[model samples]
Target: MSRRNVYLDLIPPRQAVQRACDALNRKELVQTETIPTHEAAGRTLATSVTARCSSPTFHSAAMDGVAVRAADTFAAREDAPLELQKGRDYDPVNTGNPLPEGRDAVIMIENVLQVDDSTIRIEAPAFPWNHVRRIGEDIVATELLLPQGRVLSAYDVGALLAAGIWEIQVLERLRMTFIPTGDEVLDFSQRPTPQPGQVIESNSQVFASLARSWNAIPSRTATIPDDAAALTQAVRDALASDAHIVVVGAGSSAGSRDYTKAVFEQVGTLLCHGINVMPGKPTLLAEAQGKLLVGAPGYPVSAVICFEDVLAPIAAYLSRRDAPQRRSLPVQLIRRTPSRLGQEEVVRLAVGEVRGRFLAAPLSRGAGMITTLTEAQAVTRIPTSVDGVEAGKTVTAELLVPEAELSRVLIHVGSHDNTLDLLADALMGLEVPLRLTSSHVGSMGGLTAVKNGTALFAGAHLFDPETRDFNFPFLRRYLPNLAVQVVNLAIRHQGLIVPRGNPKGIQGVSDLTRKDIRFINRQRGAGTRILLDHHLEVEGVDFEQVRGYEHEEFTHMAVAVNVLTGAADCGLGIRAAAEALDLDFVPLARERYDLIFPAEHAEDFRLQALLALIGTEAFKQRINNLGGYETTLTGQTMHPGQGLE
Candidate 1:
């Protein structure tokens, strides 16, 4: 049999998901288990529960009063009173107590005048059945209390107990066994420092958390190698246990070492190999040994998406529960997002309310970018029919964070800087926590976000060769009409980061022309790239002379990583980045990094708090400790076109 390329055979997410549900339904995976009613909250009822006996089995008092016959109070009036003998026409009763055999009504104690212990007087008539709880009023014996498929709640538990029910039949919680497979994956439980080519096994843990959140019981097996026999044995072992579902992590792709699909085919029937969803395209679904089997992609984000879109629904179906709803809000897109014509895409977004409108800025779309998942507040789904959504288009975004928290977010879109991370941490530690969501698309991209009112502030370090100044010149040129406040964040050291001991002996920008030394460059529109260009021009050096000048990284830390991993001989970045990677740095120049905000947002609470924190002695002390930052002018605000003295 010829194996088809799964990517070419991609199916719509809706169809792919329905296939899994169909398999479970055909197999009759739904099973019932008996559990105590008190512990059944959030579990679905597998059997219709009926009242064992009527609540308040006999006529009972609804209040603390005297139970009496209505005939005894017939002559009672405000002007003419009547008395009733205890144990004959009236009896003392508390709330929920059964009424006396001869009593037909209850007169509240306040209305009864206690003349003596054996007698009581009333100036008002007692109406029939008044303040009296009749038999079968709450629930009738053998009547349905909860229907099959009803999810139990706290109030439901009370009703069950009142009907004399101690245990109930509920759909069993879906049990999932996740097996992580990879030769390069290391066990984080042992606290092993992975050598090169080794990654910490964490996708199983991510899957476990997601399963638990969906009310399923999850257990992770020990890591297995990429051998097909080992994976086949593991799946067989899981199928032999009580687990209703088995998930194999990290071998679903078409790589040579990928054996999840082959193993699933050997053990059972492969339902579908790939779905037309980005990041989670390699998801695999199968049925084996009268159980469900799933293959999750290795990437953390892909694994999470598979669990949510495919595995979660199957679990919900087996438990006879509806899938959890995703909260969505309509948000304006900050930029155009392109997608394949036939494939649906899930874009993670950093969402915030700016100028009375919700703006969603897209995060990194890389399947391996787990940080994007952590920082995202919402995600926008693009259906498979459209090419893409244009900028400024109103799109419905499913919220990850609560909608209320978006108002408190400080959106920063700009050039990447390490200090921003520090600032985010400090802001969250405040009395009222504040979230800072930043998108690093370079300095120019940030300025554009601010111009469009999509960001609260932007970090800029733009350099002008003619004026020999930073930031202000470009602000005047681009945002001529908009008033902006440029506040100094720090003056950081920018230079070439090389391996320790200066193996390449790359002294300055001119040395980049040497054919032997490979250089890593920042992405276009980045302030660092602009700075590099200006220096290269001044030194009369053409960029083409530099080897690997077009190899781009998005952040200083990325550049440092490239140098540390021997991917490049050197890269231009901040001194702090080199120090972090234990690499040597060659001093080049000091540049001002400023936070640029619209004048209208100068007094915004979050921005104001950030400014106040920046000026504090403690904050300054921390910046100084970072080794390359100078805090002399930190927190000072300036207007556009202001001189940089």
Candidate 2:
């Protein structure tokens, strides 16, 4: 609970994590075999699995339709409809049906009208290869169904059976056993829950689940008494069993009750302990008689971290398998965060949409707090060398979700606009997953992203007095050749976000020039920034003459946080951010916020999601709730030459 702690020497994030991994003996273990293809769903492949035969060996129909030779229907015209009788002219077939000999095209049942006596009339000429599924269209016979070391998917199972491969070579699953050793630890099974200091042992569950997710079987998770004798007995039992990997939970630290190191050294060679990572530093790795033992920390995130840091790799080595879990990305920080100099910090984050952009909000982290990880989408690492990442600084993060998610996300990197969430949520059940990653820079920043091709689209509200418009002039000047369809996200009022009840006694953008005022500004090139700058120029106010002009954050929430914490007097953002934080809003300018994307990206599957949201009444309802927003341009597309500013 002490906010005051002495500074500790730090180390690079990568080196600390790597040293922890390097200590384990992973290069020598390999246990593998072959199994039935049907049972390979959760198993990793030990060797390449080539297809025994091609899928869809013959030409077949992809849909239920009448198949006819292209040459037979080539001369058919709409006015003079061609009549075909089944059993003579063509064969009626259903989906997945093999194409009959001499047939090269298909006319959908709906495309042809049925007449009297088994005859059908075609209104148009069907193309030569229309609706025809060619031989080996899906896959070629004797081809690779799965490559060596490939983890099998659901589709892979179906393909394996289709290819006539009954069995497949898979890495033998790594069998792990977890032994929880801590005097304070209590099992979670059938519990009313432990009161305060009494621990509910659940790190084993995390390890077991993660192990299962990686195609490894967790054999037994036993809660051993805290004493060294009891711990030693448990370790012997695990070694006696068929387990290939052993995880000793909780007791790896140098504390008296923590006998994992002692027990490991008594029976096996201790590899290393105390990795340079926060929360899960007391990790132990050992090897004994061809078996690997990993002693993970008791803290939930720490347990999960050690599971990923230590156990995952050992399991991979034992099975001769590598499971690709979720993916990762490098993103700019929304706020400043510090870390210990000698240890790596794995900070969890809840990624959210802000101003047509994606921003990661750091979560409350403690080794004992599992809820933080539960709310997190990814883990951002801070190196030991620095206390934390400064606001607007970029850092790498490993996603706990899927990488395909990145494709589903329409990354917006500017201006706080609420319409984006509306646009995204409207894409529910869409063919492609739709998400919005909005980074709240100002309108100008968004335009720059569009210009730099760093964003799919930005929500911009830049205004031009000369042309009496919003966005078009800037887009034309900055993003020339960027053929974009500017669809209005919303028409919102530009304003100053202040603490509740207007404690700052500030009104209008001119107050920003006040010497006593400390301000949080939107990032440079952001739409909000452009709006602020334009207002300043029109009012003849020099931004450099203002106080705290250099202070900036990536999202409205971060900006609001600055105001709430007294770091700044106010910031330029949407009214929603102010209202959400129970803050005050001072209207300055009204501008149209539209999505700006590369013209070529107009058809990106992800943007369809934004369009869906814009078109929905429900999305409109949400936007209506956010004060100072107008939804008229919600779904309408504005082309390059259009004059709407």
Candidate 3:
């Protein structure tokens, strides 16, 4: 082959994966080989597997007992145990043992103890399948076994061999070579005390592991010194070996001694260098005499990023390996983040429950920061042509983990509840990861979210001095025709949440009117804001006279956050949100925070789920444990107009 033919058509990871797949099409399996059914785990099926004989080939004992006809033990009971002649009326057999012909059921061995010579009695009647394995019970002949391209399991091998089948055809494994390069870097085994400007080498190990996990054989995983000559020799050795894909860890940069691109250019052909991506900007693609080559970064995080986002995808397609399904989710960005207009940026974030809102905190965006990935729950890709993304902007996140786990989460909008954390832990213990997205706008914010259909449900408590009613009035006023089922998640004391002790002589809503007091106010559209406005008009205090009234937050926890941070002198929220941050609460009035669901969505899965949560004795007990919460109306669906509005 000519030297020019040995060049990779360097492109984005998305394109590279596609290119490899196009180059290597799916091959049909026609050959079959004999393999021990037990050891053939994770091997793909070259051809369709079909059972030659029926499973449970004959009627067999399903339990360790005596085989007897159903009629024989029909009236057998404790007082009048029916006796039967051993071997004639009933034959004893162990579990999975073949039952003698004509037997319909088997009495448990415990029921038929050793009685007088060749005779036994059973106390209970046997039902079908209770103690018998019938013919073809497990499977039938000519049933499909493994489909083509399926990775074989140990159980599949057993089934194949049990069906009297021999070796089956499977796809060929991919051979990959990992080449680590850097002058200052040391091998994984070498505990080197490096001089200034030196760093420990770890990228090759990650590269190899990543490659092997994707069904690619790491035939040449090694850390090579950064000499163009040494790299040339290593590349020669790798190409000479059986490696189909050679990945160079680091050294793709255009800097001096960045010999990956240069070496590949000399040995084969350099298709392209650099993709418009953060951290992985210096990515390189090459082909050496028909073998694909990938050049990744030296940083451990960047190296792994490049592997999965770039090479492994191609390797999977090329090897005919099934590509794992990637799911995208619609998540609202917590705050504005900047990105280059023409360069795509992959940002990592730590998703967490703050109050009842799902708040995603941006992780360290440094290219070399491994902690960015360690702390991140997911990665969001910002496309080129968009310079920046605003806070609260909805963007699609490509999930590395399963999306079902995220969907099962309970999105709560309210003031922060530490109790929600407890609930989160309980749910997680049950293998259900409950995402408690707390947007702490306080009790009022939660109701507004329910009214707007912007959230699943909200946690709220608002004290109305006039009507002396709870959420019913607000629901009636704002969300008309909203089929609202008010399930009381909590009922906490409403009041002025102050610092440790009231340093200032502050009491009730009147103290917030003081000129020196810088008050933190909940944002407009929040139920808390409505209640605050109601109090302001009744108290005859001008909001313009108050400082920090225009300052806004989306949740109670956020208000507490600002107050705790000294950003505001005081704020009005639930006692829980206040106490959580060690602030003091002056009891104003008790209020109910109920979860409201739309009438049309009354039987929706989310509402059904909320009903189950409220109905549980454990949840009821928890609501009671939270000091002021009244569980009388808890789980009760207060019909529309029964509560507010």
Which candidate leads in lDDT?
1
**Window of ten residues with lowest summed lDDT in model 1:** 1-10
By TM-score, rank the candidates, best first.
1, 3, 2
> How displaced is residue 369 in candidate 1, in Å?
1.4
Model 2, 1-645: lDDT tens digits are 212211132233234344434554444444577788888886777777777777678888877889998778867788989988887888888888989988888889888888976898897888877898887787787776678767688888998888888988776777789887776788788583776567887887887788887777785555788777888888988888888778898877766567787778888876667677887787777777667777788878888877886566556555556634556777666656778775778898756433445556566677888978865667887877787777667777788766555455556666766556555566645666565555565677677666765566777777777777778888878777777777877777668998888876889888888888888887777667667778888889998977877887767777888998778889888787787788889988777777776767756666665676577777776888977787776767765444443
What total of clashing residue pairs does each candidate reach? 0, 36, 37
State the displacement of the C-alpha of residue 629, model 2, in Å, after optimal TM-score superposition: 35
Count backbone overlaps in model 3.
37
| lDDT, ranked from best to worst | 1, 2, 3
lDDT of 3 by residue, 1-645 (tens): 212222233346676555545443234211234564566677666678888877789888877888888876778788878788977788888988888887888878877767887988777777765667778777778898667777877788788887867666665677778877777777667678866688877777667677667766775445678677989888888888767778888887666667887788788866567766776777777766777778887776667667777776666666556665567666776657799877788887545432334445455577778756654566788888799788677777766556555555555666555456555555555434454444455565566656655566666554455567776766666666677666666555656767777677668677787877889887776656766777778788888877888998766777888877777778877677787778877776565666655565565554566577767788878766655456666677654344432
Of models 2 and 3, which has the larger TM-score? 3
Tell me which of candidates 2 and 3 scores higher on lDDT.
2
Model 2 spans with C-alpha error above 4 angstroms: 1-30, 33-35, 57-95, 98-135, 190-197, 316-336, 349-365, 374-378, 389-645
At residue 553, give the lDDT of candidate 1: 95
The C-alpha local distance difference test score for the whole of candidate 2 amounts to 0.73
* Cα deviation of 519, candidate 3, in Å: 37
Report how far residue 37 has shifted in candidate 1, in Å. 2.2
TM-score of every model?
Answer: 0.92, 0.54, 0.55
- Candidate 2 TM-score to native: 0.54
